[model samples]
Target: MTAEGKILPIVIHGDPVLHNRASEVEEINDDIRQLVADMHVTQEAARGVGLAAPQVGAGLRIFTWEFEHTGDAPTKGEVLNPVLTLLGKVSQEDPDPDSETEGCLSVPALGYPLKRSAHVRLQGFDVDGKLIDFEAHDWFARILQHEFDHLNATLYVNRLNPRWSKRWKKELRKQGWTTAGNTWMPGDDEDPFGHDAEAANEAEES
Candidate 1:
């Protein structure tokens, strides 16, 4: 499908930038603003709920979300240099242990059960650099946490249970992925899916 905006190439796992903390967005200039818009297009093209700067080869602390599950109008915008706070338990009513299984654009064909606060508050600036703060609950809250993890070079798989984590590592190894420090990705010969399997993984996770 044709996207209305530029769809930047997604940086795959094992890329150093994905394992390092992102730099704060100090200025919301033309480049940054264009990037924010392009990221939204990339997210939509991949059918993802959110996208982060690092995922698009940028090391800026920024992310965009398009959440339609908040039972309100779809919440869509960019959050620059975001700070997140958990508001309360994951679910005030009927908190189920199995309620949070998450999928990632960076990890294809894999889903990990995660634990995230059911309610949260996110504060950051928009593409225009105006300060914005808001509360989120349920799925929206989970999406925020997921995207927030990106700024710290954290993937949802990093929060997987020990057993599942080990299993995922084994699977990755079988696909010829190599590890450097805490990051892993497909080896040169293993990159049969476009730029890397990880990038294709992102496209499919949506």
Candidate 2:
């Protein structure tokens, strides 16, 4: 892999690439390795724990993750064409908003609660085609599930409870995000979750 990778623009929620299942990577090659490298860079640039290939406009089954809040040492790696196994039953009830909240880079600025399995196992190939088998729990498991869903053309918002899902759709419409071609550059664009200082002050005064 190259020592450095370029940051790629992130596609938004309405992009067709995000809605279509990604094709498996048939061969591990320099290009695939480069894409993995760039995905890591993009994930970090967006301050996200994980990112999928489709989020970057590539219709390939791949994802990269770097998270340090799993109550253990930081976990970081890339998985290609992953197969996920849930270790425990996922609760069907609405998730607790305080603890189960999730945010997606594609959705930008929004967060909502969604239920997910607490334990999971993922098997996949690394960038070099080596086998990768591991288990994840807590937030790490959530991250894995979130990225895996991307490979299957599902987003977290799509998995939200009906109430939250409707709200999310309304927000998407308000922001004009229901069509394709929306994108954001990491370093060049305004912070996705950053609040405008003036707006904040005005709200506070009001």
Candidate 3:
């Protein structure tokens, strides 16, 4: 983390910032660099593998990720205005429920299954405005796709099949998250997921 980095409040699902498409970073300057740095701190505080600018209430097309697969060197960095290309034909069928489960910081604790391309190519500029291009597979690819969707104003729940989507929407309503301007500060707030017995059972059934 940079010396100026601070953990910013993570916006919740109801926030308009998470629903609208993010703007491209017009220039990589101190503000943009500091935003990325703060995002890294916020992601670490939330114990998340990936986080997008919208999640931090910034409508900028930026995201940061840090993951270390077993036996592989850690992959960690931030990208601005990323463009993703699926490597092959994507499946229309719903992904296996047992696998491909994903959770979002913006959505708090709820996780759902969604299909994603196993391989993808992502191109973007780093914080310093240098171009970055690379291909990723498996979990790395999934992370990129998730963040890319944020830039386009598509949440993972919005991509779920009808049944799950309905359930997720209902749950969101039940939780009173249908409005904008909601946020949660990591460490300061109680566990947002609140994994109580009933909540766990509800998730299992959903």
> Which model scores highest in lDDT?
2
**Per-residue lDDT over 61-100 for candidate 2, one digit per residue giving the tens place of the 0 to 100 score:** 9999998754443388899889999998899887999999
Report the CA-based lDDT of candidate 1 relative to the real structure. 0.75
> Candidate 2: which stretches are off by over 4 Å?
1-3, 69-74, 195-206
Off by over 4 Å in 3: 1-3, 70-74, 193-206
Model 1 misplaced stretches (Cα beyond 4 Å): 1-4, 71-74, 90-98, 179-206
What is the alpha-carbon lDDT for the whole of candidate 3?
0.86
Model 1 is weakest, by summed lDDT over 10 consecutive residues, at: 183-192
Q: Put down candidate 3 lDDT per residue, 1-206, tens digits, no spaces.
A: 34378999998888888889999999888899899999999988787889999999899999999987542323888999898899956788977878888999888889889888988888898887778888888888888899889888888889998878898989998989889878889768766666444556898999
As a TM-score, model 3 comes out at 0.88
- Tell me which residue pairs clash in candidate 1: 90-118, 105-202
Better of 2 and 3 by TM-score: 2
Rank ordering of all candidates by lDDT, starting from the highest:
2, 3, 1
Give one digit per residue, the lDDT tens place, for model 1 in 1-206.
22245766666566677788999988878788788888988777666788889887788999999977644433888899999999876533432347667877666556667777878888988877788788888789999999999899898877766767887788777754454333223232333224455677898998
lDDT of 2: 0.90
lDDT of 2 at 175: 95
On the 0 to 100 scale, the lDDT of residue 195 in model 1 is: 49
Superposition TM-score, candidate 1 onto the true structure: 0.78
